[model samples]
Target: MDFRIKWLVSVLLIFGGILFCTAQERSKPLVKHVVLIGSDGFGAYAFKKAKAPNLRKMMENGAYTLEARSVLPSSSAVNWASMIMGSGPELHGYTEWGSKTPELPSKVIGDGNIYPTIFSLIHQQLPNTKKGASYSWGGIGYLFEKNMVDIDFNGKTDEETMQKAIEFILTEKPSLTFIHFDQPDGAGHNIGHDTPEYYKEVEKIDALVGKILSALEENNLMENTVILFSSDHGGVGKGHGGKTLLEVEIPWIIYGKNINSKGKLESSVVTYDTAVTIAHLLGLKIPDFWRGKPILEAIKYEEK
Candidate 1:
């Protein structure tokens, strides 16, 4: 071959090699889902006492934070809103189940109407990023409009919701998936937090966790994604209503993404911190109004 032709070909090959490497480096990993599993009315005491193998496995392989308190009143409506908005009750105003405006029958409580959710923030920040979403009973879908997430499924049966969460982990593989289990808390309300029914619900929830973990492992997502298991609020005798330990303190666990080996949060992390942690995970710039810090220490290490 002529010297000039050989030189040109060599240069093009080298340049092409560089581009290939760069593309590989920039390629987003398969580990995209951020599973936020909420165990309603599950308190620290319940976590410690509960004989849940799946939850125990998560604790052993994830970061632990104690004294994680929900907001004042500790009601689901207030706390879940705080979690999704990355703000306190002030921004997402719905502290009470129903604000008595003189007259009007009691209506269903909703978080989206009162608060702007993380889904909206995610859409605004990362327009191309699609999020996997499903909430059984939290009624958080209204905040995340259809345009915000490519896959939006809510208000499904408990079995259906749990299965959908697993399906998203397998097929959709969203960058963020918020899964809410309206059990234990629901059971506790109908029965009692410490009752047999509540415990049964816990067991069922643990099984669901196992299913999710199995899906992650089968789909090879355990190394990159962050699996967080938390509770909106804890219930006591029969329900959660006030700022008692049963109402405020709940389980906070972060698994995968090397989160298992991180240090704990010294200061008490509020419910709003969940949103902050999620935003931080996705490299989003949190707004100034956000009163919580990202739990950066709790990320599982995986090769990018």
Candidate 2:
């Protein structure tokens, strides 16, 4: 009887220890890497007609919202800056579609004498971690802190840009990677948004997304990598920079590594929230000046 009681107590203690360790592991940050893919002007409305199986699969497996909104004016530079900076044009001061620099002085400046961005946050918090950005648009190069990034490649075409980004991801295995494809916005401007041509361009961008996913999977990085897909803005009839829903509504999708498959997020998501979400996933402290909050509904871990 004494031996059996001792054995039962030992088993209970061991089982309790295992449960505690499992809980601790889950409580800690689960994401080791983050990849943000932005399409220049892919509209939320286009998803209804666009046949993008890869993106659709991500939507089914992750938390997404087609009703996510862009900041005012809904232009490329303004919204992209907002997305990565965790603030809107009013704070970051990139008021124009082609702003090469802050038109107005930024509210808060970080290491590069520019507005604080996710790159700035990562560089400050995770000093040794690698960061990379690849984009077809040259204007995007002016928005973030280039000095902090390991690779900032600006390609002349969307395909070249995505390829370079993939190469960087595979070679460097960066902790954070941001890729921007310019074809959809270009097609939206030239061919017109909601048109078959624009949808085709968006489909091509989806294929590029598939390539990135495949690269991550082939390199055994997908399981621990978190991917967030979004757009700078939508468009209306060959031109954007408007207040219409058709021009302001963008799709936001978050998948992989501790993300819950809530499927179709009901909470309102804005462009600036993207940065906060990335910071949250990487377990970095949020800047005091950042107005956006993390979309906690998409994450599986409970906040302590």
Candidate 3:
């Protein structure tokens, strides 16, 4: 072969190899673990007014949107159910806070016809992968399956919830973990949304969030984890359950793993999108019955 022709072929082969490697890297799933943080009644307005240094820092490193909308009715039970089940109240059949012990329906793992919670779907699809949650609102416990969750702790206060969540992350290292804080909601009901006392609670929740993030950092799990910070519903005038702006709009922050650290995300997201997004991040099969769609724009990757 001619000398010049041989050099051009060698350069082409090298570039092709590089492109192949880049494609392989992009195809691999970026998230190994998912951490979902739920702060009840934490509205965007309150988040703006609150002195949440920790959460602000996280927003700087993640894709965030204060315009994320909640489901109709805007109640805690309805919204949590929508987020977990990836379906509206009509499909999930959890319209209201029913009983202290909510009974299981006909089927646990619903087919394409029936709606299933993300926990149940994960348990059925990825049996070996561990799943857990530490929630302050025990009522949310009704939405989960006992056998599906490895650790289903109901802490009475935000402090206890964060403590248990941090411990679970470090000790169990579950594939999926959910942490819920209830103080802000309680504060919203006690005082009012955007009130000084409510903002104080929001700040306190920020500190608790910092503790959990610190735990992840200490364990070196931040890079491989997708952390989703959100709220079930926002409140208005000392209560929620209305379609007003304060009740419908909430803040959502997606950080870590392959998430973009750019400015606020303009994507329109709702409570129902949480489960499908989690499934997508963990590389699980999204059920056809699910109405929510994954926020694919949040994923940042290079293509060759």
Candidate 4:
């Protein structure tokens, strides 16, 4: 072939190759990344009346349960561990604030609860896809299992924790992320569970939620992610670790493309079901030890 014709043929081949690569990249299924958010002291009553436009949008766009309940005494350590381990007060051990357990020696925060965190499980199973990413969950200064887990930001303020969360999801894009906001809870204990602080802090946290959502949107990871919003426990008469509604009652919202938007919650659900739910959504089997049902009701789409 002449030089001119050969050059033209090479150019067409390169263009075709580019188009083919683009098609393949676009065709790949979006990976399922779990982002669990905890709004401290955000109860059903507070959630219902809270003037949070972002939370309202999440409730409408996804799913919301009026009867969500936290762990016993509604303490952060118990509930967070329960949700991650997919166990109850019996299995996960640490069932109260400032864990009385003689082990771990660390403060009874996010890490004191004894159980397999969702992060540890997925990191072990999905190592190839996970890329060993660094993350900053909502709770700050708490130590959980360091086995393939990062809890750099634990028990921090609403804005601070959310900033860390957004940064982690945007920068690391972790396969699993859990965020806890100790706002209303920390504020609630000082001045009654249902005081002005609860309302004000919840609204503040809601703004952070919107900001995080915006980050996800900008990164184009909204559709590819599974979001879980819950609480450690509610506060009654100042602090939690009680069975009362003010302490145990919570609000649950799960949204994202992998979930079923219209699913209805049912039948005595608790924190134990959360970890299994995340595992189930990620196309992974619940471990034999995970004595919790996958909240099939909250899931909008049936896993195939």
Top-scoring candidate (lDDT): 2
Question: In candidate 3, what are the lDDT values of residues 1-304, reduced to their tens digit?
Answer: 5999999999999999997556323234458889999999898777667799878888898888889998877878778878878877766666653323223342234543334778877787677888888999988777766667889999978899889888888887777898888879998888888788888899999999888889889889997998898997788788888888888898888899888888598789998898888887876776666788888788887675
Off by over 4 Å in 1: 1-31, 98-115, 260-265, 300-304
Best by TM-score: 2
The TM-scores, one per candidate, come to 0.79, 0.89, 0.85, 0.78
Residue 296, candidate 4: Cα error in Å is 1.4
Worst 10 residues of 2 by lDDT: 20-29
C-alpha lDDT of candidate 3 relative to the true structure: 0.80
By lDDT, the candidates rank as: 2, 3, 1, 4
Better of 3 and 4 by lDDT: 3
Instruction: Give the per-residue lDDT digits (tens) of candidate 4, residues 154-269.
Output: 43345666776677777777777777776777678887766776788888878877888898988899878877888777766676677777677777878887565564455466
- lDDT values for all models: 0.70, 0.90, 0.80, 0.67
Which residue pairs in candidate 3 have backbone atoms (N, alpha carbon, C) closer than 3 angstroms, thus clashing? none
Task: Give the higher-lDDT candidate: 2 or 4.
Answer: 2
**TM value for model 4:** 0.78
Scanning candidate 3 in windows of ten residues, the lowest lDDT window is: 99-108
Give me the runs in candidate 4 sitting further than 4 Å from their true place. Answer: 1-31, 100-114, 129-143, 302-304
